[model samples]
Target: MFSKIRKAYQLFKSIDFEQLDKLSRKVDLPKVMDSFSKLDEKQLNGLMKMLEGGKPKRELPPINGDFYELHLRLSEEDRALQLKVRDFMEREIRPLVNHYWLRDEFPFEIIPKLAQLNICGLTYEGYGCAGRSSLMEGIIAMEIARVDASVATFFGVQSGLAMGSIYLCGSDAQKQEWLPAMQQMKLIGAFGLTEPEVGSGAAGGLTVTARKTEKGWVLNGQKKWIGNATFADVTVIWAKDVDDGEVKGFLVRKGTPGFEVEKIKGKMALRIVQNGLITLTDCTVDESDRLQHAHSFKDTAKVLQLTRAGVAWMAVGCARGAYENALDYTRKRKQFGKPIASFQLIQNHLVEMLSNLTAMQTLVYRLSELQDADMLRDEHASLAKVFCTLRTRDIVSQAREVMGGNGILLEYDVARFLADAEAIYSYEGTKEINSLIVGRSITGFSAFV
Candidate 1:
């Protein structure tokens, strides 16, 4: 006991007097010393070792998809807006996505919350829009999709496809009538372009025909896989004019005579997005309701080009969400009495996922830069769409791979991303179509026909 007291006294003498003084305020130092003096030799040695701190634990870097730090390149204001959208998504969207996704329904209550962000029509000028650069729009899209791709799809339909059609191809009257309401999300919108029979052949072969008459123009045909159409207030319908054989755009309002919409069911992926099969049996749209400037397929392509770029950005978000969730899961999940993330095989999968995700992020950033510079062409958008979406598919699949059986379980989130990636893969443009667009641009050959 005397030896223990001597050792404890000597140990305390070595501690910094300043630290001891600070500790006296919080603890009864005299009582501590008295207790320490009564300890056995083994206890004294343990106390001595604790006083001399052991080896420091190393801090590892966080897991992030933006390995190249592309988000840092955004201007201060743009970065703030990006973070705001990310916060909204993470807070409002993430918690309820799996529930809604499993039920195949949208959370309509979020529309007003989404409107508060003031991001709709972000790249367009005037009409209550932000009129920000396209890069900002891409970042916003990525952030929204990083939580739920179905919500992102609904937004893209409203902001990009529906509003972009009017912004790029509508007359002054049409813009004034629609852009503001849509920008506020007070009026949800959808785009009807892909027909049941005509998927990739929409450029020259639209079966939906519009016949001109003194009363109005009569449209007859069917449109399938129209996102948001089940609840959209308005849809931008593309039809071929039988008189001149030219493609024209029309703002077909809800409940129009002879226009019928049937909600599609049993979708394998992106089920939360309300896709509709629209039937126009002699539906009459006013002459003024037609997109005044959309005279041919070339005019329609303008809107597609704009939205396709946004789709590429959305693909990045889906891959990012998957990679991040899978990365986090690996860290917590243990195998063989250790974290699976520490395993060489698991680390290889993680590194491969990160490599693809980083590449996608950097490519989309440059793609948005080109768009903001007004130098973006069809091939440019198509290439990014092709690469990002293709890589996103692979990244999500690998994310599932690392997660083992839990990857398919919805609670883990990678499963949702994995399922949603299939929808992103086919929408806006398919891989084959986009690749051909790039191929034609590089080779100067018309392979699409």
Candidate 2:
């Protein structure tokens, strides 16, 4: 009897006295206590657990941005490489970007690490390149931009604009001299074409002039908004030949006499990329250094068309990163009792963002397929660039809207993506120019000022 009384007392101590008192008013408290005293040890434990609400709520699966499982389409090897690049960006690039972006400086330390990947000149046939498909190259561009878009811009300038100029246009000797080193990233390159005055009018009216000289070609003009020019070992300078009245490309080495570059500052987007304003007063290039095949503006346009496709891929990365981050944020943040994501409006915003992102992804994938098949045209690339970048702006804006106060904070990362999306939208080609290119193809009209 004493043992029974001790067991009952122990069980009574475990119960919430307040709850017991409330129950006493509604039921036979003595009867409940008597029943608890009769329960075995295991049964007592089960009762306590039930009252404590120890059963966990259902857990959801992780949030993955790949809604349509496009990765399933990749072969085993291609998907492995894609994940490798994605991991590298997340581990190495993510931690350094916000710091460099705030100060408006490039993270020069990452160059050696990037070289280790051996991904530069990925699609070109030789010169120590991977010789991968355009799909792989576009995947890499997307991965790099997923962490930070400024890094993507810097890479596109080097791998696409600069090296592509040499690969497509440089002679055999020039290729042997530069391609291997540039592919290994032992030598960095830049593209110099846009000018302070002549931007959209570069094809017909390039102010930069390459005049024939007894020594070589003397290039005289200013090239503005040239990425990597400040530190690039070689810069591909496109100039109008005064003699032939045609545009030509020259490989102007860094520190060449009469070649000067000053870094452009005070940018709100892609701050980590070093854009330079180049001033050339009689900058001379040897006959051998000139890109052999780049004899006209048409050659330059080819390089632009190819790189424009890469920019479209990069824009998709920026949107996906923002959407993923915002989605996770909504799930964690709460306003009343449940996660804000539980609200109907929040789900609508996320679904809208996912819809746009999936469309951009599928479109770029097909764009790369066309490129691999060699069916890509100027209009095809321009349409992708126009559509992707424009959609990216809308996606990032919605991402920021969901985060409210936290969205603008750089720590949240959407802020940087937002700014960099602006740069991508403007660069490669402006929305108006790209749209006109598509418009001209469809309607057979050339409307330009």
Best candidate (score: TM-score):
2
lDDT of each: 0.92, 0.92
| lDDT for each residue of candidate 1 in 1-449, tens digit (9 for 90 to 100) | 78887887787687698988888899998898789877888888877778778555557679677888887888899989988998999899888999999999989999999999999999889999988999999888999889989999999999999999999989999999999999999999999999999998899999999999998999999999999998899999999999999999999999999989999999878988999999999999999999999999999999999989999999999999999999999998999998898999999998998899898888888998998888999999999999999999999999999999988999999999999999999988899999999999889897866
How does each model score on TM-score?
A: 0.89, 0.90
Positional deviation of residue 127's Cα in model 1 after best superposition, in angstroms:
0.6
How well does candidate 2 match the true structure in TM-score terms? 0.90
Candidate 1 stretches with Cα past 4 Å from truth are 1-58
Query: Cα miss at 383, model 1 (Å)?
Result: 0.7
The residue-by-residue lDDT of candidate 2 on 262-330, one tens digit each, is: 999999999999999999998889998889999899999999998999999999999999999999999
Candidate 1 vs. true structure, TM-score: 0.89
RMSD of 2: 4.9
Candidate 1 colliding pairs: none
